[model samples]
Target: KRSCTHRYCFAVCIKQDQRSRHARGTVPTSKERGVREEQIVKKIFATMVGSSSSWSTALVKISPYTFASIGIAISIGVSVLGAAWGIYITGSSLIGAAIKAPRITSKNLISVIFCEAVAIYGVIVAIILQTKLESVPSSRIYDPESLRAGYAIFASGIIVGFANLVCGLCVGIIGSSCALSDAQNSSLFVKILVIEIFGSALGLFGVIVGIIMSAQATWPSKG
Candidate 1:
């Protein structure tokens, strides 16, 4: 009976040890499960917030094509305005002076025509600029880099238009300053013609150079 009691005590101790081990293991597993659930909730919340912000931003984004087209249209309009004003001021002044002078002299005709040519030149240049700008690849139209270039071209167009306007004004003033006696003298006519021709030529050359420089300098943005 004493041996049986000893065996029973040993078996009871072994069963208690197994139960203790199971309980200890379960505590760590439950803690790990809780940590995993918290991480999942945090990730879901962050994703939801990020998605909402992106949707809001997308609504404000401008299309590149639309921006470029609007810029081109404005540029062309400015050119037209400058050109029309230049023609009216210079051409009308010349006609009025010729009528008052009552002279159908070659010098008068040449002077009138030279002053009038600025408007025609401006139109031609504007057309060329429009053509060049329009020919730019459609694929590149909306690119940030290309739009930057377009802006530069627009700026150049503005400068050229202004220069032409100034040139026209100067020619008109020269015409108005002329006297009937000055027109009769061939030597004086030659001298004045030289100066006028050189000035108008320089203005035309500058416009071309400005366009070329702007086109070359303007680079596409790599957004």
Candidate 2:
């Protein structure tokens, strides 16, 4: 009887120890869950930090000077593209007219030279517009704070750049055609001298437009 009672007491002690261990394990698991919840809350707060900021409000805060500068730049691009396409149309028509005419003459040469100059004027306008935009301070330019103003400036630049590009193409074609005519008609020696001047004018126009377009395109809008 004594031995049987001793064995029973030992088994009861072991069961009690196991129960205590299980109870302790439950506490650690609960602590771990709490720790995970804390981490998740921290992450959520970090993610939502920027959600309350007003983008439109920031856009409204943009400066008027910045808007004007960028708008002008874009306008220059549009102007260039417009002039280019226009010149191309006019020049192509002129070429067709020249082909149907009796023959290449001094009168035709003079007309062609003047017609080509119109495209050069377009380039000149683009250059002036671009230079104006470039002179503006970087701080005045658009950034995230001035989203509306910034985008507007960028749009203007794009318009002017494209317009200038088209204008250049038109001038080139017209100038080439004029020179070829002068070359084919050897009798117009005096007119050949004028061709050089016209060609130089085209070259100058191209250079000015190119410089302005580059400046407008490189200027940053958003940060």
Clashes of each: 3, 19
Please give, for residues 85-152, the per-residue lDDT of candidate 2 as tens digits: 54554456546655755354444455445434444554555455445443335674454434433443
Residue-wise C-alpha lDDT for candidate 1, range 1-223, written one tens digit per residue: 9667655655565456457757887433656646754655465456545566676566335443344344345435544554455445545655665565555344555555655566665556556555544434655655666656555555566666666666666665555444343535535655666666765664576477656745643444334
lDDT of each: 0.55, 0.50
For each candidate in turn, the TM-score is 0.52, 0.30
lDDT computed for candidate 2: 0.50
* Model 1 accuracy (lDDT, Cα): 0.55
